[model samples]
Target: MKPNVLLIMVDQMRADCLSILDHPVVDTPNLDQLARDGVLFENAYSATPSCVPARASVLTGMSQASTGRVGYQDKVPWNYEHTLAGEFTNADYHTQAIGKMHVYPTRNLTGFHNVVLHDGYMHYSRFKHNTKTIESQEYTDDYLNWLRGKTGQADLIDLGLDCNSSTVTRPWHLAEELHPTNWVTTESIDFLRRRDPTKPFFLNMSYVRPHPPFDPPQVFYDMYKDLELPDPSFGGWAETEDTSGEGMSPVTAKGLVPKMRLKRAQAAYYALITHIDHQIGRFLNAMQEFGVYHNTVILFASDHGELLGDHNLFRKSLPYEGSAKVPFILADPGNNLGLKENSRVDKAVEMRDIMPTLLDAADIGIPDTVDGKSVMPLCKDGEDMPWREYIHGEHAFGEKSFHYITDGKEKYIWFSQNGEEQFFDLENDPQEMTNLLKVVDYQERIEKRRNQLVKELEGREEGYSDGKSLIAGRTPKPTLRFVFE
Candidate 1:
């Protein structure tokens, strides 16, 4: 029988938050145990570093360039022919997505047999003008409808917190069992109980938390309310000024927040992560009770990382480690594929790799459209297997638009709006506190990485490169024309 696959995904969680990774403040005992049972990938990234495009890569098993979703534009149709769930469905698996599809039309199944979606306060979908259409959460979000049925509330944001704001935070107002995080687990457990027992399953249990509004359940919030949390890392290259009042805005993307306010946000953010972690534990226990825990292939990851005041940045879409890196843990508890247990791999992987990896675990054939390689070999003793030299990441963030190349030990970033550049020796400067572009010892290394970026962009329609040098001042678009074609 084919092994069941469980892909547990979270939103806006930092790469370093796992307690196993020595995160001083946050504790994720369940995830730490999950890592011990399988493999922990230390250098995983979201190439696009935003929700829409990053999730596109996860679902389609394609790079950002191939998906033509290099930024955070919503409402574009997910026109891909092959998806992770579609492939599993082709193999006769009972595929279900329980939470947070984040796709356009909101309910577009994207190949899942069914989707229980709650995209978590999408501004475009929740716009008063769009509420009459399918774009509204009222029409598409199962969790929202369910919440209303349970609490007589019209919306999840009844507490008046902006979904995207990092500065505002409070404990969850509803009953703990009614929270979105718990609802995702509760629904997932219910699926396991009622699912087709004759066929293997492919379940994507996604959560939207640790993202914003900074609200975890009240118990979780109090757990870290007074604990000393690590201060956000500040790079010398980051602007420290509060000019233009952007610093005081609740949803400011890049600005200096008052230290106390930032700390409260961090506390709430960590609380959400731990809450999700416990919910994951709850789901795993249910899997064990159902007698499928040992036979399952589990993969856990996040769409992207939140900056959370790192370098004075509050949200994602930047190429910094705090914004792009994500936690990736894959556990094959049954040893079905001969994977090494409790291992850590330093290979630089990304969201696109996930689909292929899970497919490989289930002995399914990968589709031709996939650009990512299966990490199964790396999980075993196949060190001799050829691997990617680096990962190329980019985002279209207007004035802050950037393309980056990193091999985990070093990173090179180039701003498209201007000819500005930043380089970091990631091994020595893990916090990215100093830019090393002008360092005499690293000029040659920086040049080689720059050429790699040029090669990657050679034939793109954006005219970002000339096959020899990167060109500046080109307008960066959220998607390429091919997506429409």
Candidate 2:
């Protein structure tokens, strides 16, 4: 009787925009029917791609140099011990967390039993930058105090837009039920109709609009306004060009925006990813109208990935697989675990294996200061497990601080601050557009992933690896510049 977990998350989403990851135009028919009912890790990742250190390595399953958060700092002090909804709210499960919780005293219930926040538009929770004000939206955010009690309004500045802009692309001006992705799916279908039906629930809807004021609601921006979309992934070790008009700024992260404003900002970022995939198909038909949809397990992920402009980059810290890959899926709904429906695990996983694979699929236990492991024997069938051939990833965002390591079929990176070194072969250029690190037939596979990134950055201190090499120009720090005793 343990199942029910749900966890949806999504902010700056990308992992090739799922249409089962073919994503040529982003339709996501209910996340491709939750990837045909389960298990599609196709090399997931988010080893610190952004959003507060990829949600602090997804609520502490660890890694990101053991949760000290290797970059993108904000307030710090999540003081973790164990989490993933505090170990399924310590096995009794009834946790909550609706919409975004970018952590830190914006009411830190890092172990949610309730978290109806709406961390959208956070410029460090601006109410004049912190200590919140503007009189009141109930002191800052419960989706802007329920959109000022359904728009009798007071603020949320009538969508002039700037929730971390990508410069511009519009549509949603108002009423899509005051869109914060439909107020996080109507507060997660009103917490599955006022939850607590004898425990067994974990919730956490999370979503902060494809991540940006990419706005999506003029009927999902005219349903991809005159389709044709596709052109961005360019890379011969990308530098970018063609800034046609030279006025870009909806939050410009690099350059070349102006192929009709980068196809109307990629058609308003695929109309805010099909309006958050039809508001996650109305929060999965309200979890099958409260029966918790066939026992439940679901999971879908995304704390990172959204280079929307690819190598010309734009948003996300960028080691670039469209900004550090992401889009795991899990789904169980009582297939009785052993995953399999629409299978595809291709190894490499990350974001610290999502809290020991949802606390080892609810029997719950995984804690030895978790460093992530439980992929439930790679979702069953033959079950050999023993994975992790590679996963390391990094961020720091200064001169776009870097570091990487892959194993989802080759990738090495580096770039601390111009010590540059790239080498991709993501199974024959998965749009990483070739840079076999000076290709002398891939110098012994770039000296074995640069000696596994010098044994994963040996004893860093801006030294950036010396167990055998890679010392780049250094000086990058937003955090994790070194403090581990």
Q: TM-score: which candidate is best?
A: 1
Q: Backbone clashes in each candidate structure, one number apiece? A: 0, 6
Q: Give the number of the best model, judged by lDDT.
A: 1
Cα lDDT of candidate 2 equals 0.79
Q: lDDT of all the models against the reference? A: 0.92, 0.79
Candidate 2: tens digits of C-alpha lDDT, residues 184-254: 88878888888888878888888887887787888888878899988887877677554453437667787
The TM-score measured for candidate 1 stands at 0.99
Model 1 local distance difference test score: 0.92
Which 10 consecutive positions of candidate 1 have the poorest summed lDDT? 128-137
Root-mean-square deviation (CA) per prediction:
1.0, 20.3
Could you estimate the TM-score for every candidate? Answer: 0.99, 0.35
